[model samples]
Target: MLNTALFMQQIREHPIVATISIAAGTILASEVIWKAVKFFHSQLSGKRPLRVHEVLSFNELGDICAAQHLRKSMPGSPELTKSPEPIVLQCRNMYCSLRNVGKIVEQIDRAVYSLDVAIYTFSSLILADAFKRALQRGVSVRIISDREMVFSSGSQINVLACLGVPVRMPITSKMMHNKYCVIDGVERVEEIRRLKQRKWIRPYCSVVVSGSVNWTRQGFGGNWENCILSEDKELARMFQADFTRMWKAFEKSENNLKQE
Candidate 1:
């Protein structure tokens, strides 16, 4: 009532503070209105408001269904009566630590046909041994990595290469920063056809592992990272296609080097 113009001038001078204050007021008003609506609805319906635990459980179920729908709706997705369960790992909660690394190793160990990996960094010895064991089991394993990172100290790329794993790196100076692995199932085209003919569903499917976490100790233990292991055949097919394209590109680069 005393100095409206002065107050307005001050607000104009500090636009950010004014904006924050307005936003806070809006949020507070919205919360008040929402609570009022809920209260009135509860009174009319004679139903109590949901407890925190009940709300959380409902949200958890929703999340599971959402995850399933996301993978199921993709093109060429497998026909399934139930949702496919995926393993999620987060370093912030210790879900992506060394203990959980066994989960990835377990998938690798189970690979019967092929294993394809594309990663920015490769230095995890545990992962390296898992690949070795897969190779010993007669599984075809191929790796694609960043060209520069391969020469980095403590990198297991060269070691795996020496051990007979087919490794490819782009010749470009720019980093090839992708972290994914595709684990192919044992079912071949003929096997799938045979099962279809016999009216038997295929039990095994390819798996795709991807996320922000690199194949390194720091990525698994130190950094805030997340990884997802999905048993979606279509998703695995997509990753496998990308890996194939890169593998061919790297091979072309090698040919050019030979001519040069």
Candidate 2:
């Protein structure tokens, strides 16, 4: 005999299970209704619904009627709006990827000082390629990563090393659960984790920033990923400081390896 109340309580505690159950029930109901509708519609004109064109605002019309809008748009090159300062923030809901991150990185042809990264998981093809390009264009790149999270063991490490991107693994108690990448002297944004309430759920809601809409999904175990970007010099300087410390720690660990 099964205890119905106890089973219900267990389901309530597990949101993923509950969501799956609801989705299954809804899908089942929809299938049944569709079959019934088909059976009735077989006797009538079978066709899909027609599309509709709704009226849009001037800005919306600007998007649609491209040539006229561009013609009507102001002539002397619109004034550059003052970019608001970056803020300190945290998230577990942002999803972006290494490839997505490169859209901003590739544009940096000349870097005077340095670029530092403290990433956990990265074996991204695009990431390696972008770094190669940046290095060729003369940017001092250093990365601190987890030893265990190396994306691949063979060619990637060798190629990236040849490209002059130094990588290190941190052995601190905290599993280096950081996803933010500091770029230039400005932005520092983080990637939010992506997950389904259940395996059957479809992804529709994507978290994007007003200034950073350039993130794309690619590389590292097939799921999307993200990084926090910021423009606040103070934040960039702070992360840079943290990277320098971690780099030294990683260097010590590496020397111990060489001595061994």
Candidate 3:
């Protein structure tokens, strides 16, 4: 086996190549095994693997034209034009939709005063465009996202920042795993200070949207996720307080870093 001896000699001379070849072979073998098992299981069960088109699709979320339209403005309907009814009659409305992009877009569209978002991951361009529309309408929008994810491939945090949205990230090494938004709620400590000097009254009903959903393509369409939209003033107030604290903390950390 002179050929095999020569191959081993080359591998010994180039250890990195040998390592890469082994890794590639292991991965390919695992993939082959996985596919074979699935194929056999499907055949035994008399079921066929789902075709891509047969799966639920969210083409609108990915459509550049749709995103452009959303950036301009979502079309208004009588129901949308009317004042938003409380999302929940009692306290909270739990929504688990196979298609939740519209639900989130509707909430963003309905924001009148302020929107505060804290999410671990955000990559959906349509949702980012929705935020831009809200900003254009004079709604104050702020976001706090995970620092690591901010630099992740396809993250839109920088795009939002470039469009003049205030974005912050935690200074701690821990992940900012929050996934929530406070709508029409107090966003800043300065707002709270101003409230103390004047008769404080919320002009619009405050709402808090929080759940397992990340603002991503899979999160809205493919994942088994739940979202809760609540109109409870107490819940909204608490969420706002947390957001304000985190916003201030992030700001302070930034200032400290600049000084350093």
TM-score: which candidate is best?
3
* Model 3: colliding residue pairs: none
What lDDT tens digits, residue by residue, belong to model 1 across residues 1-260?
Answer: 55988878878999899889889999999999999999989855536532111000111122233344446557676633334433232122233254357568867877766788899998999899998898897777778888778778898877877777777778878898999988873333234346458555433447778888888877766666767777655566688789888988887443332132
TM-score, each model? Answer: 0.56, 0.42, 0.57
Off by over 4 Å in 2: 1-102, 107-112, 151-158, 172-174, 185-225, 255-260
Report the alpha-carbon TM-score of model 3 versus the true structure: 0.57
Per-residue CA lDDT of model 3 for 1-260, tens digit only, reads: 99999999989899999999999999999999999999989865536532111112233333433333333344553433444542211112123232345566667888877889999999998788889899898778888888788778898877887777778888879999999989887444347437566555445556778888788877775566667766665677899999888888898443332132
Question: Each candidate: what lDDT?
Answer: 0.68, 0.45, 0.69
Question: What overall lDDT, based on C-alpha atoms, would model 1 receive against the true structure?
Answer: 0.68
Candidate 1 vs candidate 2, lDDT winner: 1
Clashing pairs in 1: none
Model 2 quality (TM-score): 0.42
Candidate 3 local lDDT, residue 213? 73
Alpha-carbon lDDT of model 3: 0.69
Tens digits of per-residue lDDT for model 2, 208-258: 111211122222223322234333344555765566677787885443322
Question: Where is model 3 more than 4 Å wrong at Cα?
Answer: 1-99, 186-202, 253-260
1 or 2: which has the higher TM-score? 1
